[model samples]
Target: MVRRFGNGTATARAREEALGKLPSPRGRLPVIGHLHLLGSFPHVSLRDLAAQHGRDGLMLLRLGAVPTLVVSSPAAAQAVLRTHDHVFASRPHSPVTDILFYGSTDVAFCPYGHHWRQVKKIATTHLLTARKVRSYRHAREHEVRLVVAKLRRDAVGGDAVNMSDLLNAFANDVICHAVSGKSFRKQGHNKLFRELVEANSSLIGGFNLEDHFPALVKLDIIKRMVCAKARRVHKMWDDLLDSLIDHHASKPASERGGEDCDFIDVLLSVQQEYNLTKDHIKAQLTIMFEAGTDTSFIVLEYAMVRLMQSPHLMAKLQAEVRNTVPKEKDTVTEDDLTGLAYLKAVIKETLRLHMPAPLLVPHLSMAGCDVNGYTIPSETRVIVNSWALARDPSGWESAEEFVPERFLEGGSAAAVDYRGNDFLYLPFGAGRRICPGINFAIVTVEIMLANLMYHFDWKLPPRSGAGRWH
Candidate 1:
């Protein structure tokens, strides 16, 4: 057999790859760029943009001062996030991140490089390892029981329990325990954390005006408005984190104070090893608490919402959770999750339909790269719409429906996973910068959902009670 390298096909392919311009929407404003196209729900708006303009799966839009690339399909997501991950490994800088995350020193916003890699390594290996996460089994179980107990107490008088607030509190308390070895609720700091989480979500959710129009923010009016909000948030974050760190620091070396010697203790012990300063520790703790509590609870809340929407699916999950745990068992253990395959499938389905960060954290291109024969230049803010990708018709059957069975053993979409392997199903994202909290998040969400389903039967509020169930 002879292999010829002199064919015109090779040269033609190279030429095509080299000369391609990124597909962009038609109406791009001069200074504001595509900022006008983005509305309150940018994910939906951008998804529409990709559908109309991104015939090749990648759409280039100028977002204010930044050139942004939106990856709306699985194949394109894989190309950008997996194939040429290193080029798109870094995170794009935004005023929102800088102000909220203490100059983006935290893991999520930290620029991709040596410092990021070091912090990531420390977190994955020491803080969030499978063994470390599993070690907190008691803490998770304890919190879940508290959730069940509270629901029971509410049910005693036939009273409606607000799962939203209670679940938020449950997640907050669990994360507080894991982070600092004590419950923030008991300490009366849960309200502050709650406010911070709400603020972070609001600021992070939509397109911030200051982020898009950086130059416009230089005006006294815009600057003061933005700075005022940022300062208030920063002060709250600073005071709470300072108190948490101080509490841990005041502990005697041998005492090692904390519930199960929390993440705070772990980070403090290795502070010298990582050359970490107080700000660094605070940033890390802030991220851990903020991300762990807010995102996990949101997922749980949505899971419950979805379950209540369909009684059939709810019954299926309840049966799995109930059968997996013995009738006499008061709490569902982590080991029991292995046999409860359908419960896991329900969680997957929920995430597929309602992703936490619909548009994942944007990636920055460290250098120019070619995606699907199009050249994405350096410093382009790359966004993978995990929400759109999850619901893409080609990849998922009954794309808009809530079908948990699709992720079950014999189902067609069973092979897809959330652990960054299958690009089409990346609820957590992919590549070198994939979320490091996978183990922690999965465990927290699964346990919480399992207990909620197992212990109590949920009911829709009477006012909105219609034919929601199937």
Candidate 2:
């Protein structure tokens, strides 16, 4: 990042000078630039750095060879994510994603362009539409039932159930049902999906030298070392997806289009319509599987962890769920989820406090744009510190506390929401790249949590304590 060439032209030098105006935290070192300013957790590091040196919610950092613009407050977020969304809506190229997602063809990682437009249209209009999400109600309910059954069998007589494993399995099974089909468990494919998702998450989430030092990957040794695991995981995914797609494709075309179709089936039926190659179809499904399984599981696990640490919140949520749900039903159905104010409040609070992706996916500026009186150069990568924005002391009352009631009627933040309308609480993000699976993810969480709360009273295991979980 410290490499400096002779000032070649007015435009190049001018752009460099403009970037200098953006505030940067102290302690930058040679070659690494601001990379050393970041600690073990980049989001926390950015939040602390932004507080000390940020100007007008904007801070600039040179992450190795790349120069990034960090937006750390609600106003700046609105300026970038809303006002100049088109200018900063595209994703930067990543070598890892390129291999895993078939040259970055998936909706989440694809750069902003015509292909992105087409796939996003297919997803929003047909694949992940509200009606389409509703169509998976039975499958979701069945998965919840299976979860309840497993908990009943495993947690008998003061045994401590591993909610982490249980919830992870539930989330995976739910996604499997949605993606592959009902009979996926006959040969333990759900377990395989879980393993692949974990491998992918760890590989992508961990530190990668190529991300910061792009030039190093050009060497044969560095390229092989960096891309070997990605290649393995991609093939694993490809083989599994190919088998499932072939199964769906083998069936007569006459029987394929309906509410019973899995995600793969839906993608195939519209392959010609969307001009999708088999790679394209597999790419979309891979991204969808990873997103669907990982996101819901993390949120659910964190919600349970937080609630266990707070007895009042737990009781409040349980009371609302048990009282509102009909006693005759064996499990809480999606229909029973309506009007459960506290349940929804708990979910909203969970999302606000523990956004799965603390940093919104990195966005690359397509053109120069002025934000909050500062000029951002074209091709500048932007990251919104969502964790900072949601928990800002200036914006939220009791910003550090886990208070779900704040989302209730007449509460301090009753008007705030996650749909990007309110910049302060953007768990699902805003604008064109906002998560298309919001409906799918939210309903999945609601049904499983509601059923878990209704069917059993949660507590710490007998070996650990005789008291309440807290």
Residues 1-470, model 1: lDDT tens digits = 11112237775454334324677888878888788898767788888889999967888888886677889988899998888998889997767777777878888989998878878987898889888898888988988888888888889998777888988988887887888775465788867787787777777764577766678677988877876776688788989888888887898977663436788788888889998888887778888877888778888988888888788889988988887799999988888888889988988888898878888898988766667877666666888999888888988899988899998989988888888999888888899888888888888999989988888888677775533221
Candidate 2 structure, TM-score to reference:
0.95
Cα lDDT of model 2 overall? Answer: 0.87
Candidate 2, residues 391-432: lDDT per residue as tens digits?
999999999889999999999998887888988878888999
Pairs that clash in candidate 2: none
Q: All models: lDDT?
A: 0.81, 0.87
Ten-residue region with minimum lDDT total, candidate 1: 1-10
Top TM-score hit:
2
How do the predictions measure up, each by TM-score? 0.91, 0.95
Clashes of each: 1, 0
Deviation from native of the Cα of residue 258 in model 2, angstroms: 1.2
